[model samples]
Target: MAKRGAAQQLQTEVKTDEELEKFLARPGLLILEVYSEWCGPCLGVLGTLRRIKLEIGGENLHLAICRADTITALKRFYKRSEPTWLFATGGKAVSIFYGSDAPKLVAVIIRELEKTLQNASRPTYQIGDLQPIEAEVLRIKTEAIKKAERIEHEKQEKKRIDYLNRCTDVIMENLPDIGVTVFGPQVSRDMFKKLSEPAEHLKMQCKDRKYLEVFAKDFEIINYSCKNPLSDDVIDQLDGKELLVCFWKIDEASGPITHVLSTYAHELTKERVAPPDDEINVPHPIAPIISPIKVKFEVEIEDGEVWVEEISSEEEARKLAERKAAEKSKSATHLQDESRPKDQEGAEDDDEEEASEEEEAMQAVQPAFPNMALDIDLGLDDNIVSEEEMVEEEEEPPKPLTRIKRVKIPPIWVANNRRTHAALIYVFFRSQTSGFLPPDPPPEPPHVVMAFEAFKRDDVMEVVEASKEDVPQYGFFTNDTPGEAKLITNSIYKYDKLEEPSSSDRIVLKVNKVQSYTMLSLVQFEPTYCSNNVTSGRMDALKFFPEDYKTDEEIPPDAQKKQKKKKKTQDASGVDESPKLSTETAKSIDIAAGDENTEDSPKALEGEAQTPEVQAGETLITESPTVADPSAVPTEGAPAAGDGTDTQEPPKEEINADLIEAPAVDGAAAATPAAPTDPAPME
Candidate 1:
């Protein structure tokens, strides 16, 4: 039973010699104990081996026991006594233990195991340990990688160049004259090719011959080129594909070329065509042939119905109607001719006769005022007074004044009446309900207004006379109705010269009958106030009178005296003498008084009327103020409190030609008179 049990235990734990070699070939430490069951030391070492196996566990070291008595291969391979031990690692023999000294043997095994482990852990080779073949292989791989990258870059560059070339060709073909040069980085050929389809489509779409003709005539393309080409990704978009091209138009006169950017294929789509419908065919029989006859027939179609033509056979009716119309037209023309006035020559003769009668009438009725004539014809058609009324007025001439009427008259009225006898009249009407006059007259006078009562009433004359006194600025008159008074007033007023009148101003109204028209004459008066008698005489003398009243012998005494004096002066000088400023002397004075206020400096006097002296070798004579006017007042008044009239004239200073610079007259410089020095005080 013990032998069987030991045999079973040995069979499980102990490995054969071949197995021991296989176990040593593995990666970790392998420990083996060669033993015999009959040996007491071997039996005793079993327990120690078990303890060593536990110390060196399965992970780091493998433990196997070989019974030399039971295993022939291990028995021959070990060739050691019972209880001997062997240690191997990584297929190498580490050490062999011969005696049964458990502690010493275990120590030796552990030391050898550690030595194998240390050797196995160290790298087999140091840095720079590559073989020749490996170095060559690494270099080849590096060169291959760089070459692949370069090829890829070249492929991309080729594609870009191709795209640019194709785009340039297309632009040049379309715009042969546009002198455009394509430039910039290359782009994708696919995008450039895609642009052409739409560009051609646009060219086809512009079908108007006139537009094409105008484009060709107005602008000649000198060059066309790509600017910045589109990218491949952008061109690949489903819609809105655009390519920009720069085109330059050449000027016919060799002027500057116009450069413009044009886009193509930006938005385009294929034209859609509608599908055709199915067709149908049907056969029809032909009519049989027939012989024709030479008979004539006429057919007429009217209002969607056919009929034959027929003549009225009454030709005289239209001619008779036309003849009657002609006769009626002739009668109408004869009536129009009879309705017209007399011929131009006879009418002109009649007008001349009437003008001669009017002239005779005007001459007969001329007024008594000198150079003052009134030609009042009043036209036979005066609506205000009929011919019968005029005849009655002529028969009853204004009765001679029975008594003198005293009226306050303005001085201005007398003054104006003495000159032109013309005046402005203003008429005012009262409101029917209120019986009140319109508010204060307009700023300007000679205005007409409606009256409460008609002018024909006797009360109207009293009202007008009262108004004349109440509103003294405006003249009031009444004759017939207010409407007739307005017409006469407007004709006489003509214009209003005065706006507001002073307290002393007055207006007078005179009513008279001229032929058939009722005439109203107005006389406005504004007083003239003068401070002195001289002003009054001058004002009166300057009054304007008609030319017929003026005569050559009527010249004023003062004017005749002025003309004689002027003639005497001209005779003495042989020419009219007038004082003029000497520009050269004034310029010299301005230059001499440096930095001084011009007003403070003594003024240069004007040259006297005497002829200027001419210097030798000079054409222009520089005139100087040689003689001061005795009547002229001195600008620098008498010193302190003395009157300016008492001041004596400053003595003239002789000019030095060398001190001043004046323009050369003929060949020599013109002499400028020196400015006067400060004047000496009078005694």
Candidate 2:
């Protein structure tokens, strides 16, 4: 077994806004490294950090690492690949830098340490709003996470299939009398006395811990209360094998609320149908409830038995279990008596002794090759040896066998009447659970070797569909849900903005949502142009499900045209204002900053107040913060959403590398904590 280490390597772990505030409240200068899980920290700067710590000592400085993706205060800094260094004295950031340049890193550390020691600090501070991470680093090693999720999904599917399969077998095994529920034409007397409450037996037995344990193993059933959100129609549709696969996804997303609890808990009027009958422990009623029940008893033939012979569902289930166990026991005993004194019996007797030798040998030699034999099977002359081989360069990922083709098709949602004039920007493959289902008895799209194509919904440009077999891909370029897409165009916007607002309307586009099954278009948005927000955002294709790839490394022609269009947006310092985005990014943007009252065009972005300086298929999130009320904020305060007061954040500023390289120490870089944080962490 591998040796286990400490639970966390960081000297201080700040997981929340409150946690970070607490860390900042402590004395001394704190060096907080803005961190990301996707990329790695710079290992080369560790030795310099160690020497700086030895010289400066502990009380004058501190160090820490934080995940921008999780910690709310650092969220906007999510996904950065380059190392971001933030120097904080007290609660405010004193300086910031990017990249792991050793000289600059050391200088910043020592400079801040000395200032803290002398109590000579500046009056003003920079609220460090960190840079957004690059897309490529966000992808590295993530395949392992996706693979793990896919494996877990498969395990659940297997459980469901095993359950449903057994249900079918049980009904078949008890041919003529699986148990009858109806009063047939031949009988005035019913074997089962009708109870006013039908299915009460199931209601009672389902909750019984013992019964639940047994039933749960087969049906994938959990928390099956009377409050389950199964409508009559949903029940009728569940006759197919895909019921479990679809609902909990009913095909993975129940409108982004994947679980039943998330989808219906808000509507539920009661915490539980069978709430405890106590005055103080009262259950509060919410606004909504699960579908009303008007269950009609249906008579179906199970092995030609339209009548249930058993007195109760529980008693019947009990009998079935007992009968199965008895038969299995009898069979085992019979087999044991018949096979007495055989070689198998003697081998079974020696199992413990043989196993002991095997256990002892396992420590020294574990035979784990896929097709290799055990110790018993090894030849007399076989030898186990360890060989040291020269390390080879890592192999590059396999190139996509398919090309992204550009074709013209009228938009899938917006401007349907318009002829084909959009370009496909991206195509992703997702499992059915992601909530986008293909046609019932879906027509085969002639399987190709792993391939992808792109499309974007725009006023004018041509696009083509990239098809795959099982998964559904979502394009988050639109500002509305599936039903609200048509409500976007002036001629096309169908819903009233004041009366019926889209759930994701105006929200910063961080995630992708698929509304259309086909097409793409791209072009310049006229004053009347209704298109996806390309500024303040960029594309990111986070592929979900196993072997479902969204590899579009080569840029299509339309992308080049748009890239040229955004060229004038460059910074005055001659630095390229536009980010070097990876081709695979889905290019997301939040156009929600627009005012709703400003438009009657019906277009989703018609009221967009800001044209955004960063114009392209992507948005530069670092450029601006959405300020709800400027009057309420302090003169130097950063802008924030919702609240009148801006949420204080670290500023986005960089300390240039000053060429202050320290002499290198030869030992392997160790975990050396400075102040309270690990300034230079090994990747």
Candidate 3:
């Protein structure tokens, strides 16, 4: 079967059943396709079969189709139903596929051949009742169809060429001034005929404008020199006039065409009409550049100080240098005096010893530093102090600090972290005339906030004024936890006034993040304090910790005593409870807690513990819990009156909810009796 496939290529042999059988007799495949002459589908399939024949022209496979009307001829194989195909191995039909789909037939033949050819030897069949005349007629019909296809392809090729010529003609019409300066590699005269023909306008310019002509490097044009690529005299003639130029080709891998083009454009622009040794000052107009020039234009590299004004005269340049020298001299003198050695021994001492002495002096009395620095205890072992000495120290051994490395923290990092936490810090304009205020922080972990996105707070003014602002904002914060959300101002000068004499309700305006802030409010002062009257009405102005805080465990025993005395006097005086001045108290709490604990811990009684707010006419009535140690007998401050009578109300009534509430803090509920475990007992 393989030999037949190879032999068929060398001769125009018609396939007979006997030949197919002989081909299949070997260890190969037989594909018998059965069809009728009257079937239109069979004709279509024959075309595909010829295509397949071309594709697999060298394969060990036989394809044959029998007319169903001639049943006796196909009896040994398979009968045709419409068009049918049989895959045979070793003279026995392995599989039969019936279809008009040429692709399906081809697939089945290939699949069957793949399955059977590996295991069975090819089989031989007899070519019965087939005449040479009928085979010749089929071959003639196939050749006629191929001839028709060739005619159709040639027609398409002619149309495509006509369309391309039309496009090229249009391109050539607009390119009259284009100068074809061919360099390197000559095309034959026949190929040169294909070059863009010079139009009438270009032909006229040949006499005066010197239109380009191509010539071999060894041969010059009718009058031009080849050795000198660009003649100064030629360039002078082209000045102040537009000229189209082209390099026939360029090899960037070598040569200096780039450098040459740069020098050409520069010298042409300056109208440098003289050789280096000669003097000529010919002024020329800057001419319009015509297409197409082949030169890479890139920004020139310049020295850092290139932008400094160039002194026009030598005298002026020297004066500027002298001024700079004087400035440097003053700086050098100051630096030298400050850094100079006081003594030989002082200079000999290591920086460590000097640093230690400076540190001791700093401890004794701190010097004013411009920048805030964190004091870190770096316990570098000198080996002089034994491990025993570390153990002898009462406190836990300090963690080793290698060096005080200052790290720059970007504001964006903080803003992004806050955004992820669903909290934002941005300026919000209260009214058109007023400045913006810092937004209330988010009530979640700072690290959870997403990136900052800007938005206008006033855009949702109706929502804001309706007392639904916080809920929606919180929802936005929670929902947009992974993205930065910003609110910017809607208009200029429509925000809250920062230094205004009159106190008014802040207007709805944009509360945008810093990065998105384009309109800046020039606040007279930063960190403007909120008045008591405004805070009571606008609760949104108040900032609170994200998580609930547990009250402090205990005030120092002495501090507690001080609070009681103050409270007694307030109650005796019968004064109305004013807003708490808890700045000092908050500071003290922060100090005792080592900055980690952010609880709303009341200050130890100076007998008059203040609330956190500095607002006027606001009151905080601290109540003693039942669980509080009686021996501690802690006093809760009372509201004082003019008559010096204690008029303070008892703590708010406790409800059942208090008993079932989750612990306020993570670690401590039972341990701290000073922190009220329950709400104040009912009056």
Candidate 4:
């Protein structure tokens, strides 16, 4: 038994005749695959097999895979890259199929199963013999097939060259500028002539992949450049200009040219070849990104989190990588120095060794899962073997409506993810005109959610049906600092007129065009009260928590008591306070549990804050100015609405002062609970 790599279908690994017999004996109609050890089974077929099992129901079928070279019956397919399917029932292979033809395989299996189902008594069974062919004969057939495929490929190549040759001379106005805007420096007329200069191997991706697979091992088209690889005349033309062009051979566009990709910007520099071992490496920085839970992204909470904006170019990423690597080197040196102070005599040698170690650590070599180039995409589209590959997904049951909860976002979520804010907004709306309560906050924020991936990284301002909607926009924003990765939005569309604040700022929609938002240098204001009348049918408006807002467990015992007592007393009075308003204000502002000395806490404004909305029918509720301790001050000259009733008020705990002057969050009010006195609750 030759040693096979682990990726080979080893679950039903057939080593001996006994194992093979048992596998075939599996109760239902079984499809056993034969694969070589060196050349693994086609992985793309795994999805198809899974669909077959799921669609037809697994109880009716059994699927397995085993090494081909080990089984004498499969010796003909031992080294073949194409697949072989062995259909078995009643402890033996009944029929066989060669090639990874998904449609043919599916049709055959389905027809067999249908025949079995229709003729239960008088069954139609076709016994196809599994014979092993002579190695020489197999080689001859393979050679003939290869020669035919080569001629066909050459013909296609000629066609492609003819097309390019026509375009090279004649200035055809339309030269198929497809994917230029998205994946380009754009391939222009003059540039297309220069594009024909990417050495012959580079033009053909297969040839390029074959070369890279042997040398690079990573199966990626790494762009490298020399100061002047082109002739002087060519160099003179493109010297200072960015090469706004890329080329895709027009020949390979059936369906599988699917992964046709983009290029990395490689600056042509002076040719400087060094010894392979001493290539003078630059190591990438290996700093752990801060992404903590609950309160805020630990990156923001921790001192280690580095704020990295857009790494716009390869130059920028490389520079950042170098700086990160250096930081690690220094940190490692510091640790080593502490551990072995007595070895200070060889400190210089130790430093050299450490530098070498860093270089080795950053070496672009991954030895594990060797020969994975066979599976790597490498910008080649695979041939679609099956026609009409429709995936019918069973309709899942409608999930119960969930109330939106606070999402504790990590700092790393902002990196490479442009839709960080926009996506979180959709969590609230059931549809454009409808609103639904998001699910309650779990102990830990869910780090993943389902999404339909329609846009790529470069598709920033794509216009969609939803984008044209006149409905108000929604998204996340940070209150702690401006321009931080927003956690969620406080977007509320109130159909009520608002009172003009003396010093409130306004963003006049001078135009309805979309503009990128800038943050932190903001004058945001939040209302102290959240009205329950915003939703239609007077449904309580959905509310969620912010960064400063503490969970039930985080809330201090005394503060919780104050909240409960306050709610009880409010019920006693005729004040119609919304449950959300009462509880939301208390949970949001009761950060008395936090370290008072912590400097990061946001400072609220002095004096009482006001809600701009002054609807006649809408009852007004405010987080009235709270005293340090309610018992310290005595109430006087207050109207007794509770008929001579002496009621106990909420114990006034001094709320975090940082929350006083709430930032102007559009929909949500700055809900800091007022210190309740032993009197009728203020309305």
Candidate 5:
């Protein structure tokens, strides 16, 4: 059966009756055969059917062959011989052919197709068609598509919600705890609420901590342990389980909460360790020994006063020196020896050898002396001098004992703008030989004394008046020699007046010899105390009255009255002696002065004299009126005034004696005022 099925697949063959039915039910015409492969007639008809199918063309017809063994139902239904042919269209049998009659079958199929075409071309009864099944199928397909789309959207939404929930869980797990008791309940609640908002927003957007941190710019996460102790209730609720805890607080106003503290309870998990089962071998240790090594170094010795080459024996050094001397002598007289005879040269060599030997023997016997001249030989009697005699000649007589005056001037301290209340003086003395000898018991010890005095002024004259009671003497050792000694003492003064000193106040330090009272040195320094008070209110009164004086308390009443009277008299004398003109009188004077009329000049003078009533309180001068020199008067065009002295004056005009009024003196006396004898005429 499998072979027959395989053979049938090579050709277009139906495997079952149902497949044959489906083939016949197709829209186009189909021709099918039910055959048994073992039958000779079936084998012979297969080629004829294929030829007929080729003639008909596949587009308009479908040809199929079915094996009897594979499609038993179709063969039984047909009730045909070994090779039976059936023609069908639109699921109905049109013709059937038995046996291998290829020509008759083809002719019959052509005739049937022509009849069908004729029937199709004719105007057959037309019925309006409805495609309800197609419409139903389309509707079902669209519903299925919408269902799939809705499922996808739901899956995406579920995924988003699950992600959002996971993000929220992570944020909550990492959320820090605000200190409830430390920050107070209200503040802690507010901080917690602030922390929750960002977390909630991020959770809604399915964002993780990384994305949440992008928007949370105002806060930071600090890894620190909480300082607050957990309550018993919390511990009980936790059931001793290890859990991570975090603390948070708002870092700034209107900002997210920051994790300020965090802590975690560590799980106590014991890890077991198994001991090694393998045996180990231990090696013996060896100790190391360090041996010290002594290194010897050779140093070249150069001849010097302090550093000299060490000689094993003095005789060897002497011999070396003798050899060097002999070599030098031979080199020095080499030319002389060359010019001399050979016997003379040998004699000179023997003489030099004998002299070198003698010098070496003397050096070996002589004691070494520091700085001794090497050129002087002890062997030469003429050059030798006794050590005692040399010492006596070279030694210098002891220097004449001379006394040196030693004085020290210590730093002087002066108060600024204030009198010196107290001062410390230190005097150190040391003689020139004191540094070489012990500073004790001397033949003549000079007495040293220092005097401290405060002066009101910087001049030496003021030093005499300086309070002598405060000038203390600082004395050094009176009996012992004044070798090296120090005298330290303090001097204090009490001024009769407790007034602060000015910047110009000075202090004088004097060091004097006790016997002669000769002043060795005198230093004067201005006090610098309270310099800032110069411009203050304390000195403001001094600006006007620079001198200080005592105030008087008692005075006679008559003396007071006399002083007042004298002041009034002085004030009255200060007023101007010239009479003061009233406004109207001044205007009258100005008008009279401006008058061009020459005859009015006398009238104007007479008018001014007549105005005696205007000078009520004014004191007017009264003197003898001067008589005019008739010849000294200047005439018109005669030299103008101030040009040259006039030899002859203009003829004097006779004054009207009645018009000229006597000058008034404060309404008391009207007398003629003193005028010059030579009356300078007005130009």
Candidate 6:
């Protein structure tokens, strides 16, 4: 069912350097397909190449295959992956066609070949070595390029934040607070498994207090639950009242790697009240908890003489009675007020005006406000929207009022001396595939992620114990696999670098081992060819002009010869106009007779000063080239054969408004090119 050697002819494979070199050395043009077979999309590439070969399998075109396994080979010639083709001719690559479109591929190759043939018929200058002058020019160009790149990078960063801000309503939105716990999907779970392989024993050794202490000092784990579950309901039920409000968080792994990754991914949520509002008299979302839960707001239960704690105090009950009475009065008043037509109309008008003003404010600020989430709570209660209900959602079961004050404490990592001057961590595993467990019981900090606030390993154990009230228990997890460690480490390192300075800022530094060789490849040394044997050189006259010498405006052939004669006569007059043009440019212009006449013009200038010494303070413009006398040119070429030439012409050089305004050039080279071989001069 298959053609013989069809598979051999259509070898969909990666080629070694040997194969690539042999193909490149062949006659005509050889298009080598560079690709990896493991890539799923590469099959389309094979089909495209096959179609191209079928269409252009002629004498002028040839086809080959290449693979990018060898780093050296890839660096030298090919780019990574499938769907890339290098068009080679005469041992040098001429063009590249990318993608898996058959028609497009054929058309590109055909166009290139046609252009190559046409170019072969034209005259071309031999490329000379890139001397000092060219290198200097390149240096300036490179600096300009680098400056542009920096500017662009800054712009992109600003734009990225700007876009994000537009979508979110939070102010200081881009400024992520230092040390905030983050939550996000895992990016490199496999890498973590590999790196944690050798440390698998530590998972068991965690039983030892010393070992546990070490890990606990480095990290802490807590089970974080958004909803109070049966296991965690006890935290709120410990005293006398039913469970009010509780939350839980747990870390999936131990060590700096886990902490950095979780933080970078925003995997940890902030310890917060049910809802955050400025009007809330309770703790702010980012504020710290000063003490454990207080169970009583009405009366206190006493242990012997000392009051152990109050479940509810008499004073609090009285206050609640007063609040209920006020509510009852307010309700009665509202009922009576609703029956009044004037009151009803006034309330309606106020509501409409408030709604209109809010809409206007939102529209005005919409562009600058990113991440704006509109919350439409239809069942929101109206108790005049007091500080408690307005700022923080009411705690379920009607929590007894408790005082919450903010306090500042050093980060646990720093207090426990787990973090030194600086450290770098990378994550290889994410808690996606493998769910994380609650921290185990311990005396010190529990070894976990997102618990940087715990000072000792035992503290982690305390948090773990606290979590056992409701947290799902963690068991032994095995994630070791090839390349897992590297991936995890890199992920953590990236996380640390991306963290805010205030939270985990001490760890950032210059990053290396980045694999952007496309830019680096260009900076590498390569031999250059140019015409100049001198260490430094400048552009030649012909380079500025093409051979098709047609100008938009041209002088007549007779007029051209007359111009030449006038130049010769100027030389014979012993005036050194030759100084105006550079020596190299003069040679390219083929002004040999002018220089020779200069040598023969001593008799003509016998009485003239060589310098034409302008009398004290008189400008040279007052002399010959400017404000010319009526006798400057022979009237209408009265002498038909001026200076032995049939055609006598007026001066070709004329000043224009712009040229006259240009600053006079100092008698020196305008610019110089740098030489690679020469050391740059010290300023």
- Provide the global lDDT of candidate 4 against the true structure: 0.38
Residues 1-683, model 1: lDDT tens digits: 99677434432255455665565566666666666533312555666655664566335566666666555544443322335566666665555566678788768767766776677453222111333443575488567656754665677567655554444344334433333212111222343344345435333222111101111111111111222322232222212222122222433344222211122211322233334435424343332111111222232333455433332336368777889999999999999878877787588889999999999999888665768667888786646787898899889965443322222211011101100100000000012112222243343222222222222223333444445432222232232111112211211122122354222221222222123221121121111111134332222122211112221223455655676567445534445344322546544543543433233223323332222232211122222332354454432311223232222222222222213333444454433332233433444
lDDT of 4 by residue, 451-506 (tens): 11111101211221123232122222221111122333222111011243111111
lDDT of 5 at 462: 40
Model 5 residue runs over 4 Å out of place are: 1-11, 37-41, 70-82, 118-683
C-alpha lDDT values of all predictions: 0.37, 0.38, 0.36, 0.38, 0.37, 0.36
Residue-by-residue lDDT tens digits, candidate 3, 283-373: 4344322111322222333444233332336769899899999999999999987887688546667676888999999877765664778
Worst 10 residues of 1 by lDDT: 418-427
TM-score for each candidate, following the candidate numbering: 0.15, 0.23, 0.15, 0.19, 0.16, 0.21
Q: Residue-wise lDDT of candidate 6 within 63-98, one digit each (tens)?
A: 665555552455422223326666666766566666
**Candidate 2 clash figure, as a count:** 69
C-alpha lDDT of candidate 1 relative to the true structure? 0.37
Those runs of model 3 whose alpha carbons end farther than 4 Å from true positions after fitting are: 1-27, 37-41, 53-57, 68-73, 76-81, 120-683
lDDT minimum window of 10 residues, candidate 5? 418-427
What digit string (tens of lDDT, one per residue) describes model 2 on residues 13-100? 5667787888888798887777765444555675566556546746556667776767876774665555788778778877777788
The best-first sequence of candidates by lDDT reads 4, 2, 5, 1, 3, 6
After superposition, candidate 4 runs with Cα above 4 Å error: 1-11, 118-128, 131-683
Maximum-TM-score candidate: 2
Task: Please estimate how well model 6 matches the true structure, expressed as its whole-model Cα lDDT.
Answer: 0.36
- Poorest 10 consecutive residues by lDDT, candidate 4: 206-215
lDDT at position 200, candidate 1: 51
Model 1: clashing residue pairs? 177-221, 177-222, 177-223, 178-221, 178-222, 178-223, 179-222, 179-223, 180-223, 429-450
